[model samples]
Target: MATIASQVVLHPTVSQSLKYGSTTLGRDKAYRAIQYFARFYAWYLLSKGDKDAAARWNALKTHLGTARKLLRLGKPMEHLQAALRACLSTGPAVEQVTTIARQISYFGYLTFDAFVWANSIKFWTLNPETSTRVAKISNRFWFAGILFSIVNGVTKSVRLARETKKLQSTQKWGEKTLAAEAERETRLSVLLAAQENTRHQLIIDLLDAWIPATALGITNLNEGALGIFGLITSLIAAQKQWEAVNGKK
Candidate 1:
C-alpha cells in the first residue's frame, strides 16, 4: 500500500559498519515494539472477533504489526528481506495467505526503509546545516522513543502483576461472591473493551501523520504478534495439501 517501497532496493551494508550497526539497533527496538503491538492486536482480534475474521488475522497480526512498525520507522529493507526469507524458507508448498502477505509486507518494509534512509542520507550529505537540524530533531525523537519504551514497559509490568494477582485471588472466594465478582468483571471487561477501542481510534488518527493510510495495515483494531505468522505458514501448507487432494479427486 505504501508508494515509497515500490521502488526501494536493499543492498548489503558492508560499507558503513558503524552507521549500519547503530541503525540496526534502533530498527530492532522499533521492530520489537511493533511486533508486540501486532501480536497483542492479533490476539485481541482473535479473542474478540467473529470466527471468520479471527481465521484470517488471528495468526499473523503480531508479525505483521512488527513489519508495519519497522516500515513506519524507515528501517532498511534488508531486515524485511531477511524476515521474508525466513518466512518463505519454511516451505514453498505452504500456502498461508497471511504468510504470503507477511512475506510481501516484509518486502514492502525493506523497500520503505531503503527509500527513506537513502533520501535522509542524501539530504544530510548535500547540506550540513539542513542535516544538523534534522539530526537534532531525530536525536530528540530517538531519546523520546527510548524513554517511552522504558516508562511503558514498567507500567505494563506493574499492571499485569496486579491483574494477575487479582485473577488468582478470584479463584479462592465463595460461589456467591465469585458469581457477583464474575458479573462485575464481565461488565468491567466490556467497559474496558469500549474504552480501549475508542482510545485505539484516537491513536490511529494520530499515527496517520507518520504511517499514512495503507501502511497502517489492520493494526488499528487487531492483537497478536508472533504466533500468527507460524500459524499462517502451517495452515497454508495444510491447505495446499488439502487442495491438492481435492483437485485430484
Candidate 2:
C-alpha cells in the first residue's frame, strides 16, 4: 500500500497537473470552471424546487468569482502590454487591426473590472448607480473584444483556405521536384494546423460572447444557459493551457 501510494505521488500526470495549476491563469481557469458549474447546478437545483441546496451552490459560485477577481488584480497591465505588442506586430492588415482593437478592448474591460472588484471588497465605495454604470461599461468592452476576435478569426480562416487551395493546385506531373513537393506539403500542413487553431478559438469566442451579451441585456439567456456556455469555453481554454504547460502538441 505504501509503494502504491508512492507511485501515485510520483506519477507524471500528477506532476504535470501541479505545474499547470502553478500559474495564475491556470488557477483562474480552474476556479472559473467550478464557478460556472456551480451556477448551472444552482439553477438546476432551483428548477427542481431545492431552494436550500441552490442557495449553497449560488454562494459557492459567488465566492469563487470573488476569488478569481482577486487573482486577476494585476491583469489589466498585462492586457495593456499585450495591446502595445499587438500595435507593433506586423501581420495582415485586417488581422493586425483587429488584434490591436481586441487587446485594447480587453485592457479597458479589465481596468473597469478592477474597479468592480475593489467596490465588491469595500476597498473603495461607488454609489449604486455608478457601480452599475461601471459594470455595464466593462461588459460592453468585453463584448467588443470578443467581436473583434471573431472577426480576426474569420478573416484568418478565409486567408488560410485560399492559401491551402493555391498550394494544392501547385502539384505538377513527372517533374524532378521531390524537394519542392516536400516543402509545399510542409507549408500546407502548417496552414491546416493554423486553420484548425483559428476555428477552435472562433468557437470559444462565440460561446463566450453570450456571457457579456446577457450581462449587457442584449440577450435574455438564463443563468443555466450562460453557465453551460462559460463552462464549455473555460474547459476548452484550460485544455489549451494544459497542452502548453506540458509542452504537448
Candidate 3:
C-alpha cells in the first residue's frame, strides 16, 4: 500500500532523491527516510514482542533442542531418524521436542533458518573476507517480493476504484443526453407528420376542384400566390401573438 500512498506523498521527489543520492541533498533525504522507517519498524516489532510471542518463540526453541539432543547422542543414522519421527507422532507437546516433520525432515533446521534470514538481507553478503559497507547497506533494502507486491496491489486497487467512479459518471451523463434527444426527436417527428397531413389535404382540395377559380387566370395567379403567402405569414404571427398574450396572463 505504500506504493499507492506514495502517489499523493511526493513520489517523484523521492525517486529523484534516490537517483541522485550521489549528491549531498539526496543523501540527506535518504538518511531521514531511513531514520523514519527504522523508528516505525522498531515500534511495530516491539509491540509484537508480547508474553504470548515470547512463549511461542521459546517453545519452538525447545523443539529444536529435541533434535539437537538426538544428534549429540551420536546415535546411528536410523536411530536419529527414529527420534525425529517419534517427536512428530507425540503431538504438539513434542513440537518443541524436535523439528517439523512432513514428508521430509529438515536438515540442520537452525542453521538453515539463519541462512534464510541472512539471504533475505542479501544472505552471505557480510562475508568475513570480502564484505563492504555498500553490501551491508544494500542488504537492508532487499525487500521480499511478496511484501513489495502487496504494497503495489493495494495502491493499484485504489487507483482503479477512482477511475471506475469517473467512468460511471461519464456513462450516466451520456445516457441522460441520449434519452433527452430521443424524446425530442419523437416530438419533432409527430409535429412534422401532422403538418405534412394538413398540407397534403390542402393540395388535394385545390387539385380536385373543377373551377380552378383562383389559380387558372394568369393575371390573378401572382396575386393569389401573394395572398396565400400573406395568409400563411399572418397565421404564424397570430399564433405567436396568442402565445405571448397567454404568457402574460
Candidate 4:
C-alpha cells in the first residue's frame, strides 16, 4: 500500500515535462508519456480502497480519456480544456491540484508545436550547403519559428510555476491580483500571435514569392515536398492560433 501511494505521487503526470536536449525525438516520447500517465493514473485509482473516491477518480479518468481521443481527432484546444474542466470538477478540488494538471496539459500542447517546428527545420536544413538561395532562406525562417516556439513554451511553463508558487504563498486568490494576471496573460498572448505571424509571413515569402522568382527553381522533388509540408504545418498552426484567440473550439 505504501509502495502504491509512492508510485501515485511519483507518476510522470504529476511532474514531468519534456527536456530541451532531445526535442528531435520529442513527438514519440511525448506520445509515450501521455499514454503512461493515463495508465498509471488508472492503476493508482484501482489501488484505492475507498470506493467513493475511486468512483470519482474513475470519472475523471474518463474525461481525460475523452480529451485524449478528442486530441487525436484534431479537435481544438478548447475541447481539450473542456475535458480538463470536467476532470477538475470531479475531484481533488484543490487549487494546487488544478494548477498542476492545467500546466502539464499546456506543456503537452507546446511539446507538440515544438515537434512540428523541429521537423520543419530538419526538412528545410537538409543539404543546406548545396541548396538554392530560396531553400537556404526558408531554413533560416524555420529556425526562427522553432526558436520562438521554444521560447513561448518555456516562458509559459515558467509563468505557470510562478503563479502556482504565489497561490501557495497567498493561500487564496484576490480579484485585483487575478485581474493583473489576466492582463499579463493577454500580453503574452499578443506576443505569441506576433511571433507566429512573423514566422507565417516568412514561410509565405519563401514558398509563394522567393521560390518562384529564384533562378534555381526547386532543384529536387524532395525539397518541393518538404516546402509544401512546412507551408501546410504553418497554416494549420496559424489557424489554430486564430481559433484560440477567437475563443472557439
Best by the lDDT measure:
2
TM-score of every model versus the real structure: 0.27, 0.94, 0.18, 0.24
Off by over 4 Å in 2: 173-179
| Runs with alpha carbons beyond 4 Å of true place in candidate 3 | 1-57, 61-114, 117-151, 170-249
| C-alpha local distance difference test of each model | 0.43, 0.93, 0.38, 0.44
Per-residue lDDT of candidate 4, residues 1-249 (tens digit): 999998988775443322321332333323333443433444455556555665664555445434443344332355357546656564323433443444444444444433343343464343434344434444344344343434444444455555545544653444557787777667656655655554554454344333223323433433234334434544444444444434445
TM-score of 2: 0.94
Error of 4 at 189 (Å): 13
TM-score of 1: 0.27
- Model 1 spans with C-alpha error above 4 angstroms: 1-125, 176-249
Q: Which predicted model would earn the best TM-score?
A: 2
The full ranking of all candidates by TM-score, starting with the best, is: 2, 1, 4, 3
In the range 28-135, model 2's lDDT, one tens digit per residue, is: 999999999999999999999999999999999998998998997888788788889988888899999998889889989988988999998899999999999999
Higher-TM-score candidate of 2 and 3: 2
Q: What's the residue-level lDDT of 118 in candidate 1?
A: 45
Ten-residue stretch with the least lDDT total in model 3 = 98-107
